[model samples]
Target: MEATQQGADVFFVLMGAILVFAMHAGFAFLEVGTVRHKNQVNALVKIIVDFAISTLAYFFVGYSVAYGVDFLVSAAVLDGSAEGSPFAKQGFDLVKFFFLLTFAAAIPAIISGGIAERAKFWSQAMATAVIVGLIYPFYEGIVWGGNFGLQDWLSESYGAAFNDFAGSIVVHAVGGWIALGAVVLLGQRKGRYTSDGRVVGVPPSSIPWLALGSWLLCVGWFGFNVMSAQSVEGVSGLVAMNSLLAMVGGILVALIVGKNDPGFIHNGALAGLVAVCAGSNVMHPIGSLLVGGAAGAIFVIFFNLCQNRWRIDDVLGVWPLHGLCGLWGGIACGIFGQEALGGLGGVAFMSQLIGSLAGAAYALAGGFAVYGALKLLVGIRLTPEEEAQGADLSIHKIGANPESEMAPR
Candidate 1:
């Protein structure tokens, strides 16, 4: 029986790993579509760099902090295993590791989106190291890492805890906050805003890429959401069915609001997935659909507001789609996600509000502290000359045409 249980754990780990691994293709396509063609190569390079840096960092130290060197403690939480057991035996299942890696990889995609077109590639690369290597893992330990640290305290004290099943707060919000900080430090992209502060439109060269990216993300989102439960036992076939329903809800909302606009429809699919991520393992099928539809509607309204009102240059719509919708998911979990799914009995809606604010604040503060320091020391933004020259050519020295300094503005 013991041997059988161990085998099951291994199977879970491998399956989750495969699911998370598939997310990379999603990230690649999504990011590729978001950036202008002038900077397409640059976008691809950043994702590659993020993956490399996150993997090494997670293996060397992050794995310890998150899974814990006191591997027994985490293991005990999982299966009543002894504390201080063999590191190899107690660590995150291969599936969990793969899932976490995908989470780590997702962070830099958000960063790349915010800083697209004008960022110095080296600066972006350096930021990627800081985020995955240090920032994310530390917080991840507190949130999802076993042994129940801060998040557990909040969960118990408030209601069910700071319940983020798939990381509306853990991954998406962290990425969004870092993206926010990077943008603040890097400043707006050239031609994004006029001297008088009017916003300008920079149409993408290929909507096809964006569409492809969105579709891939929709598929990978299954892994991103369902894998959070950590087992087929915790996440059953019903949960998977709910996820499908949620996607349908999001699509329906997008169609109504988008009213024949293909771009909005594509983006709506991603918005739905991000919206459902927080409570995919917990919410009812109907609940999931409502949450997803709300996210799609919110994405359209709020994103336009961010563009027109705030003039924040989030090139890939990360702020509204991921940041705002991820927050919605957190709060949704508090309401619709029940104790059985991971919530506290009689979960107070207010507790969810507190968690959402707290997560956002933590992310914002960390991002400001880290990226702000980097900006002051090394200078985060590129020179005007470099901005005019496409980042691919200016920073990387490779582009579609070596002689072409910049992609046409």
Candidate 2:
């Protein structure tokens, strides 16, 4: 029975890892559909390559920083058969690492959307290494790994440890806020705004591709939320239901608020999912719906504000979709997870508020520190000529549709 239970847990986490890993493709295609045709290939390449670099960084350093576990031991020891091994039986620990690695890799995937058109490829690659290896894990350790006693402090002072059932603040909010710094530092994409400050729309390249990406993420998010339990016995149907309700709520609200704009509609779904991630396990379905609706509205409002009013030129509106909505989710979890709100209580509002804000501030600083140094030392943006030519030809030396590009002019 013990061996059987261990194997089941291993299989469960491995499947979750595979599901979350597939979300990287969703990230790629989402960016591909949003950026212009000239830069679509770069968007795809960046996500995949960033994942590769994130894997190396996390495997070597980030995981240890977060969890204080290292894979420096032999394979046999890692498999947990060796005497005195800390690893769980049937290699559950290894699969857990795989699951968590997928989450770690999402930081760059989130940032890729914000800096899509203007970021230098190699500089972004270096940024990915530093972020996944150090910046992200430092906070991750504090919240999830209990590295700095912040969780204990929160629990003692506020009546609960900061609760993020998934990673509303840890992954999405942090990634989004960090992207804000990079976007601000890189400045607007050339021609995105005129000298007089009028907004020039750069429309999406493909709506079908964008919708497909949203669909893929929606499907995979079941695993992202449910499998966060990390054990079959710990799984809850409440999580699955909350995720579904929130996704639909986001879509409906986005459709209404965005006036049926397909881009807003698709991204609205993402906003809801991002917000509900923190409270899915505890919130009532109605609370999740309200949370999702609020997230959709937040995304539409802030996305426009960032682009037109603020003139930030965050290409995919990542700072709004992930950052602001994620912050709301972290705070909302505290409200909607309380028994007074028809939730499974044990969460503290102040803890969630402070923890979420702390995450945002840390990521913002890290972004400026990493991207700022790179800008000073090596530069993080493409030259104006490179920007006009698009990242595909400028960085990769090829177009996404090469045959079409080669057709007789």
- Which candidate number has the best lDDT? 2
> lDDT, candidate 2, residue 152?
95
**CA deviation > 4 Å runs, candidate 1:** 1-5, 70-85, 88-95, 146-148, 338-347, 400-409
Q: What are the lDDT scores of the predictions, listed in order?
A: 0.72, 0.95
Residue 309 local lDDT, model 2: 94
Candidate 1 per-residue C-alpha lDDT over 336-373 given as tens digits, one digit per residue, 9 for 90 to 100: 77766443335556666776777677777777777787
The superposed Cα distance between candidate 1 and the true structure at residue 356, in angstroms, equals 1.9
- Those runs of model 2 whose alpha carbons end farther than 4 Å from true positions after fitting are 407-409
Candidate 2 all-Cα RMSD: 0.9
Worst 10 residues of 2 by lDDT: 400-409
Write candidate 2's Cα lDDT for 60-132 as tens digits. Answer: 9999999999999998889999998998877999999999999999999999999999999999999999999
In terms of TM-score, the best-performing candidate is 2
Give the Cα error of residue 281 in candidate 1, in Å: 2.0
Provide backbone clash counts, one per model: 5, 0
Worst ten-residue run, lDDT, model 1?
70-79
